[model samples]
Target: MPTIPSPRHAARRSLFQSGIGLRLALAALLSALVWLTIAWALAT
Candidate 1:
Protein backbone atom coordinates (compact mmCIF):
# COMPACT_ATOMS: atom_id res chain seq x y z
CA MET A 1 0.00 0.00 0.00
CA PRO A 2 1.08 3.54 -0.74
CA THR A 3 0.93 6.43 1.67
CA ILE A 4 -1.46 9.24 0.85
CA PRO A 5 -0.61 12.93 0.88
CA SER A 6 -2.67 15.31 3.01
CA PRO A 7 -4.83 18.10 1.58
CA ARG A 8 -2.80 20.76 3.34
CA HIS A 9 0.33 19.41 1.69
CA ALA A 10 -1.36 19.43 -1.70
CA ALA A 11 -2.53 23.00 -1.23
CA ARG A 12 0.92 24.21 -0.22
CA ARG A 13 2.55 22.35 -3.11
CA SER A 14 0.17 24.01 -5.54
CA LEU A 15 0.83 27.41 -4.02
CA PHE A 16 4.55 27.06 -4.62
CA GLN A 17 4.13 25.39 -7.99
CA SER A 18 2.22 28.42 -9.22
CA GLY A 19 4.79 30.88 -7.78
CA ILE A 20 2.32 32.30 -5.27
CA GLY A 21 4.22 31.13 -2.21
CA LEU A 22 6.63 34.07 -2.24
CA ARG A 23 3.82 36.56 -2.69
CA LEU A 24 1.80 34.92 0.07
CA ALA A 25 4.78 34.95 2.41
CA LEU A 26 5.48 38.59 1.73
CA ALA A 27 1.84 39.47 2.30
CA ALA A 28 1.80 37.59 5.58
CA LEU A 29 5.00 39.29 6.74
CA LEU A 30 3.62 42.69 5.84
CA SER A 31 0.41 41.97 7.72
CA ALA A 32 2.37 40.87 10.77
CA LEU A 33 4.43 44.08 10.69
CA VAL A 34 1.24 46.11 10.56
CA TRP A 35 -0.08 44.33 13.63
CA LEU A 36 3.21 44.76 15.41
CA THR A 37 3.15 48.46 14.72
CA ILE A 38 -0.35 48.74 16.15
CA ALA A 39 0.62 46.79 19.27
CA TRP A 40 3.70 48.94 19.80
CA ALA A 41 1.69 52.09 19.42
CA LEU A 42 -0.79 50.89 22.05
CA ALA A 43 2.00 49.83 24.38
CA THR A 44 3.84 53.14 24.20
Candidate 2:
Protein backbone atom coordinates (compact mmCIF):
# COMPACT_ATOMS: atom_id res chain seq x y z
CA MET A 1 0.00 0.00 0.00
CA PRO A 2 1.25 3.51 -0.77
CA THR A 3 1.34 6.15 1.86
CA ILE A 4 -0.51 9.37 1.11
CA PRO A 5 0.69 12.80 2.10
CA SER A 6 -1.38 14.85 4.48
CA PRO A 7 -3.06 17.96 3.09
CA ARG A 8 -0.95 20.17 5.32
CA HIS A 9 2.26 18.65 4.01
CA ALA A 10 1.23 19.08 0.40
CA ALA A 11 0.16 22.68 0.98
CA ARG A 12 3.45 23.49 2.70
CA ARG A 13 5.47 22.02 -0.15
CA SER A 14 3.56 24.01 -2.77
CA LEU A 15 3.93 27.20 -0.75
CA PHE A 16 7.68 26.74 -0.48
CA GLN A 17 7.93 26.26 -4.24
CA SER A 18 5.77 29.23 -5.32
CA GLY A 19 5.28 31.56 -2.40
CA ILE A 20 8.63 33.31 -2.52
CA GLY A 21 8.02 34.81 -5.92
CA LEU A 22 4.62 36.09 -4.82
CA ARG A 23 6.06 37.51 -1.60
CA LEU A 24 8.85 39.31 -3.43
CA ALA A 25 6.46 40.78 -5.97
CA LEU A 26 4.14 41.98 -3.22
CA ALA A 27 7.03 43.55 -1.32
CA ALA A 28 8.21 45.40 -4.39
CA LEU A 29 4.71 46.68 -5.18
CA LEU A 30 4.18 47.85 -1.59
CA SER A 31 7.49 49.65 -1.50
CA ALA A 32 6.78 51.43 -4.75
CA LEU A 33 3.38 52.56 -3.52
CA VAL A 34 4.84 53.87 -0.28
CA TRP A 35 7.57 55.75 -2.10
CA LEU A 36 5.09 57.34 -4.47
CA THR A 37 2.80 58.35 -1.66
CA ILE A 38 5.63 59.99 0.22
CA ALA A 39 6.77 61.86 -2.83
CA TRP A 40 3.25 63.08 -3.53
CA ALA A 41 2.76 64.23 0.04
CA LEU A 42 5.98 66.17 -0.05
CA ALA A 43 5.10 67.79 -3.34
CA THR A 44 1.69 68.93 -2.13
Candidate 3:
Protein backbone atom coordinates (compact mmCIF):
# COMPACT_ATOMS: atom_id res chain seq x y z
CA MET A 1 0.00 0.00 0.00
CA PRO A 2 1.18 3.52 -0.80
CA THR A 3 0.66 6.40 1.56
CA ILE A 4 0.14 10.05 0.65
CA PRO A 5 1.73 12.75 2.71
CA SER A 6 -0.07 15.87 3.90
CA PRO A 7 0.95 19.35 2.74
CA ARG A 8 2.90 20.11 5.89
CA HIS A 9 4.82 16.86 5.69
CA ALA A 10 5.66 17.45 2.03
CA ALA A 11 6.92 20.96 2.72
CA ARG A 12 9.06 19.77 5.63
CA ARG A 13 10.44 16.95 3.55
CA SER A 14 11.43 19.30 0.76
CA LEU A 15 13.13 21.67 3.18
CA PHE A 16 14.98 18.76 4.79
CA GLN A 17 16.14 17.50 1.42
CA SER A 18 17.22 20.78 -0.24
CA GLY A 19 17.81 23.10 2.76
CA ILE A 20 16.85 26.21 0.75
CA GLY A 21 15.37 27.87 3.80
CA LEU A 22 18.53 27.28 5.83
CA ARG A 23 20.69 28.85 3.15
CA LEU A 24 18.38 31.86 2.91
CA ALA A 25 18.51 32.35 6.66
CA LEU A 26 22.31 32.21 6.65
CA ALA A 27 22.47 34.73 3.83
CA ALA A 28 20.07 37.07 5.59
CA LEU A 29 22.09 36.90 8.80
CA LEU A 30 25.32 37.72 6.97
CA SER A 31 23.69 40.63 5.19
CA ALA A 32 22.32 42.02 8.44
CA LEU A 33 25.74 41.77 10.09
CA VAL A 34 27.36 43.65 7.24
CA TRP A 35 24.74 46.39 7.36
CA LEU A 36 25.14 46.71 11.13
CA THR A 37 28.88 47.10 10.78
CA ILE A 38 28.41 49.84 8.21
CA ALA A 39 25.90 51.66 10.41
CA TRP A 40 28.18 51.45 13.45
CA ALA A 41 31.10 52.89 11.48
CA LEU A 42 28.97 55.76 10.27
CA ALA A 43 27.67 56.51 13.76
CA THR A 44 31.09 56.55 15.41
Candidate 4:
Protein backbone atom coordinates (compact mmCIF):
# COMPACT_ATOMS: atom_id res chain seq x y z
CA MET A 1 0.00 0.00 0.00
CA PRO A 2 1.13 3.56 -0.76
CA THR A 3 1.42 5.96 2.13
CA ILE A 4 -0.21 9.36 1.95
CA PRO A 5 1.65 12.57 2.74
CA SER A 6 0.44 14.85 5.48
CA PRO A 7 -0.64 18.48 4.88
CA ARG A 8 2.41 19.91 6.60
CA HIS A 9 4.78 18.01 4.35
CA ALA A 10 2.93 19.13 1.23
CA ALA A 11 3.02 22.78 2.35
CA ARG A 12 6.72 22.59 3.11
CA ARG A 13 7.47 21.09 -0.31
CA SER A 14 5.52 23.87 -2.02
CA LEU A 15 7.23 26.57 0.02
CA PHE A 16 10.66 25.19 -0.80
CA GLN A 17 9.85 25.01 -4.48
CA SER A 18 8.57 28.62 -4.52
CA GLY A 19 11.61 30.03 -2.79
CA ILE A 20 14.26 29.04 -5.30
CA GLY A 21 15.13 32.62 -6.22
CA LEU A 22 14.86 33.80 -2.65
CA ARG A 23 17.30 31.08 -1.56
CA LEU A 24 19.78 32.02 -4.23
CA ALA A 25 19.60 35.72 -3.36
CA LEU A 26 20.01 34.99 0.29
CA ALA A 27 23.03 32.79 -0.43
CA ALA A 28 24.65 35.44 -2.60
CA LEU A 29 23.99 38.14 -0.01
CA LEU A 30 25.52 36.07 2.74
CA SER A 31 28.53 35.25 0.59
CA ALA A 32 29.12 38.95 -0.11
CA LEU A 33 28.83 39.85 3.58
CA VAL A 34 31.34 37.17 4.52
CA TRP A 35 33.78 38.30 1.84
CA LEU A 36 33.49 41.93 2.88
CA THR A 37 34.02 41.09 6.53
CA ILE A 38 37.10 39.05 5.69
CA ALA A 39 38.53 41.84 3.54
CA TRP A 40 37.95 44.41 6.28
CA ALA A 41 39.63 42.23 8.89
CA LEU A 42 42.64 41.74 6.63
CA ALA A 43 42.88 45.45 5.86
CA THR A 44 42.87 46.45 9.55
What TM-scores do the predictions have? 0.58, 0.61, 0.62, 0.59
1-44 in candidate 2: lDDT tens per residue? Answer: 23456777888889997888899999999999999999999999
RMSD to truth, every model: 7.5, 3.7, 4.2, 5.1
* lDDT of model 4 at position 20: 88
Q: TM-score of predicted model 1?
A: 0.58
TM-score between candidate 4 and the true structure: 0.59
Question: For residues 1-44, what per-residue lDDT tens digits would candidate 4 score against the true structure?
Answer: 23356777888888998798789999999999999999999999
Q: How many clashing residue pairs are found in candidate 2?
A: 0
Pick the TM-score winner.
3
Error of 4 at 23 (Å): 0.3
lDDT of 4 at 42: 100
Q: What is the lDDT of every predicted structure here?
A: 0.85, 0.89, 0.87, 0.88
Q: Which residues of candidate 1, in runs, are more than 4 Å off?
A: 1-18
Q: Write the per-residue lDDT of candidate 3 for residues 1-44, one digit (tens) a residue.
A: 13456777888899786787888899999999999999999999
Candidate 2 Cα errors over 4 Å, as ranges = 1-15
- Candidate closer to the true structure by lDDT (higher is better), 2 or 3: 2
lDDT of 1 by residue, 1-44 (tens): 23356777788799787787678888999999999999999999
Kindly indicate the candidate among 1 and 2 with the higher lDDT: 2
Candidate 4 residue pairs in clash (backbone atoms < 3 Å)? none
The residue-level lDDT of candidate 3 at 18 comes to 76
